[model samples]
Target chain A: MMNTKSLYQEVILDHNRKPRNYGVLDHPSHHAVGHNPLCGDRLDIALNLENGQINNIAFQGESCAICKASASMMTAAVKGKTRSDAETLIQEFREMAMGERDLNHPHHLGHLTVFSGIRDLPTRVKCAILPWHTLHAALNALSSVSTEADNDPVQNAASHPEALNRQANS
Target chain B: MVSANATLAKVTPRINTILDTDKIRADFPILDIKVGNKPLVYLDNAASSQMPQQVIDRLVRYQTAQHANINRAVHYLSEVATLEYEHARRRVQQFVNAQEDREIIFTSGTTDSINLVMHGYGRKFIEAGDEIILTTLEHHSNIVPWQMLAKEKGAVIRVVPINDAGELDIDAYEKLFNERTKFVSLIHVSNALGTINPVKQMIAYAHQQNVPVLIDGAQATPHMTVDVQDLDCDFYVFSAHKLCGPTGIGMLYGKAALLEAMQPYKGGGDMIASVTFEETTYADIPHKFEAGTPPIAAAIGFGAAIDYLCSVGMDQIAAYELDLLNYATEQINEIKGASIIGTAAHKTAVISFTLDGIHPHDIGTLLNEDGVAIRTGHHCAQPVMQRFNVPATSRASFAFYNNKTEVDALITGIRMVQKVFL
Candidate 1:
């Protein structure tokens, strides 16, 4: 039996109710809009990067509890981290949420693993990953990102390692 | 509130006498299945309905005893299959009260049926500058095909707007017709909102200008009685899956003359009088439109579904479903911060609603934990969503098999959703 109660823990509910870093950043270095056309979840991620480190990060969007909470936690986790480190966290979070990364294996995901429940719900995996996808788009200076299979930047990055390298260098 | 309760109490006994919902529910095996340690409360009939045992048995019987490629064979199985398939066509023709049996063409489903007309009729008759009238209440199946045709032929597409209650603006619909208007396509019942459009009146208005009208009856046929001849709609399309039958089979009921005049949408085996490398003459009305080998078994299952529905009278089903809708409406309205999206004067048993702070996706996910299956999203009617300034809505669409107990379960599930969010 899939435990939906485990999915909607107090942490998630609290985050959804009073999201942290829930605003647009002024004079942001990177910004991107994320849309999950499936559920009409839309998120705008804006971050200010100073000396290759994220000085500030914020998100404002209309999304489901899973998505809004994921966005809230993602901004808190990546702020003040180096761009490479933030990118590494994004990769790890995506792998964990997709059930590809075994929790027994080494990872830096920490409390972010609460979203692992999303793996059981195939329809909601995109909800948990949309914010991370938007972060990747923001880091690469892409204007927008979508969770739709054809337009997903994360899937595009995985299938083409060369594209990931190109995006990182750019 | 007391008077409302009184009205509900008075209506329930009359409805129960008309239709024994308990007996009807027993015919569906899926309604007995448990989901996540809870009994399934299916409220997503607007998307697709559950098949009764009769339809399922029909499919099994066809596959086991009488399965073969239909037409073009003198083999025993082939003849049986062809006869059964054509018999299914007659059942559908009678179900919708079409004038002729030859008028019904089996397509993949509602979307495919609309596309067939768009290709066969629109492509031939509609030229540049011709206007096609559609409404905000249309499903994407009804709207997108016309939009595609308009784009391809440089034809103008006019839209009739809806009021806040999601009813089509009748005056606006009437005004959309003009000398330039060549065709009108609209939804009979809104899948998302449950608003039953005055399609008969609208069809009559269009015919005054000689513009042919096609009613997308996908959502209407399952819930109410449909009389094609009485409405005098030139074309009507619906899917069998929504009527407790198998998927991948639906009917497109076009007037015989119009169907004969239109070009064939697809050309292949079984839809030809004779084939030549240079040119091929198409067969008569229905076969000309249904090219290639159709889903023969599913068609027979559709006929069985029709028989099953006829056994449980449409009037009885409509009255019972209306009571369920009313009871649900009264209950959901009592919940603060939960607003029903479409509150039209006349509707089927569909309730599209929104919670003040909760997304419909979250509502749907939480409701599933309680085995309450609903549809949540734009419902392929983004224009309607935009009209109401909502991105998406959580919809609970009821069928005749659903009882008030399931509606109560849905209400409880909604409260559970609210508690989790809180």
Candidate 2:
């Protein structure tokens, strides 16, 4: 008995129609790109950080309504949060996504809880996580001190994508 | 002793007209169902055609009455199974006008058939630096196998480009053929665009270079009568599901010489003469390729589908479908924002098009609201989409049972999409 209201809420459609921070960031502290090759979904995320906390964040890409709106919601949610607190929120989002965190537990999700209905549609989980996947990549990029001038094959190959995510929290 | 056109004209009148939809609809219980409380307008036939009652009945009949493994047992039911299975093979041979039943090897479906050739034939002859010519208008199934072969073997894939009418550029194709061109693998008809290639003449040309031509007849087999002898293609593959049969059954027809020359694609119980720890001698022709307990019921059901088609007649089906295609083109073209892609003169009833300013996803959603089904996105032909310079298009593919009423529904649905979006 899933209502269309929960699935296609006005707020969600509003964010989808007019996404926030929908473009690339230039020479930012952290930058990453995530692609959902199946549906041709892509997102480029950039972060401006100050003293181990997120100061400003932006994202831009072309994607389905769910993904585009999710990105808009995510950037709005994470702005001005400490890196550690943002990581906690990422966990909260993940828990909400997997249903490990109670979708009905009103306090845990905050304003980002519109995606509770998305958890029911497995195909849409990826769309909801588009921004998070890119954010993970951006977090990873932030912690790496390896320079482009080094041109180390192992370092370069290992530094991007998964390595970026691993370094974020570690 | 006549041109292909003349032969087509001569055979047109004698075409079998077996199925009238008003009666045929009763055979398929699914057609009677409702979507959003409206009649289901099933236009996704190219993706997979619906099965008729005879095929379903035959499958159930075999399982209940004569269920047994084939060519491996000596008991009564075994013999019955073996005879029926071989008889089905014979039917397929005649259906495709193949030279012999031995040339027909059953596989899981079209993808499996193509994989068999790519692994079996491509590994054998397509060595390093050799080339395989494929069309831009192929399904991912056709494109991937050759790409896999090319990557491993260091062979290159040469795509035959399409013209404005969505037909292959034959001039560019002629230029691609040379000594290093090991094979030309082409789709008999495009699943996405509905463009039918002239495989007969192309095969003739490729054969002159002593290069074998492999035709993917997955789309063609369902829409028209395919005579492998007439096409003179080195190999042809198509699935039964797209031709009113159940899934998990497909046929791979190759020239006897080519079949004999290529090694087996898979290895298991039925394909072997005797298996030793060291080595095994493979079984002969078709069985050599058919490695295990094949889709016995599905194969038999596919045979039944052939019987159904033969009764209805391919020429009559083709003629009737042409009428629908013309009608659909007329209707679809009338919409202001609607523009049909792949305007090739000769095409199946597949109409891929874009509505001005509206996302295909939106269009598909609105159509579904009206109980109409249509496919959206790249349709598994990304290269073709790249060629057309569009991200995706909404497609409505037709089959024998689809009629003018459905076309009207589609037009109305499209206009609704326009109204909602525009």
Native contacts conserved, per model? 0.79, 0.00
Best by DockQ: 1
Top TM-score hit: 1
Per-residue lDDT of model 1, residues B293-331, tens digit only: 899999999999999998887766777788789899999
Q: Where does the lowest 10-residue lDDT sum fall in candidate 2 chain A? A: A161-170
Q: Spell out the clash pairs found in candidate 2.
A: A23-A60, A140-A164, B18-B312
What is the C-alpha local distance difference test score of candidate 1?
Answer: 0.88
Q: Which stretches of candidate 2 lie over 4 Å from their true place?
A: A1-13, A84-103, A108-122, A140-170, B1-19, B36-38, B277-279, B419-422
Q: Please provide, for model 2 over B1-422, each residue's C-alpha lDDT reduced to its tens digit, 9 standing for 90 to 100.
A: 12323444556645334336777677777787788677999888888989988888999999999989998778999999889999989999999999899999998888998999998899997899999999988889999999999999999999999987789998899999888999888999998899989889899999989999889999998888899999999999999999899899999999998888998998898998888899999989999999889989999998999998887778767766777787898899999988898999789889999887665755665577678888877888898888888778889999888878999999998887665543
| TM-score for the A chain of candidate 1 | 0.81
Best-matching candidate per lDDT: 1
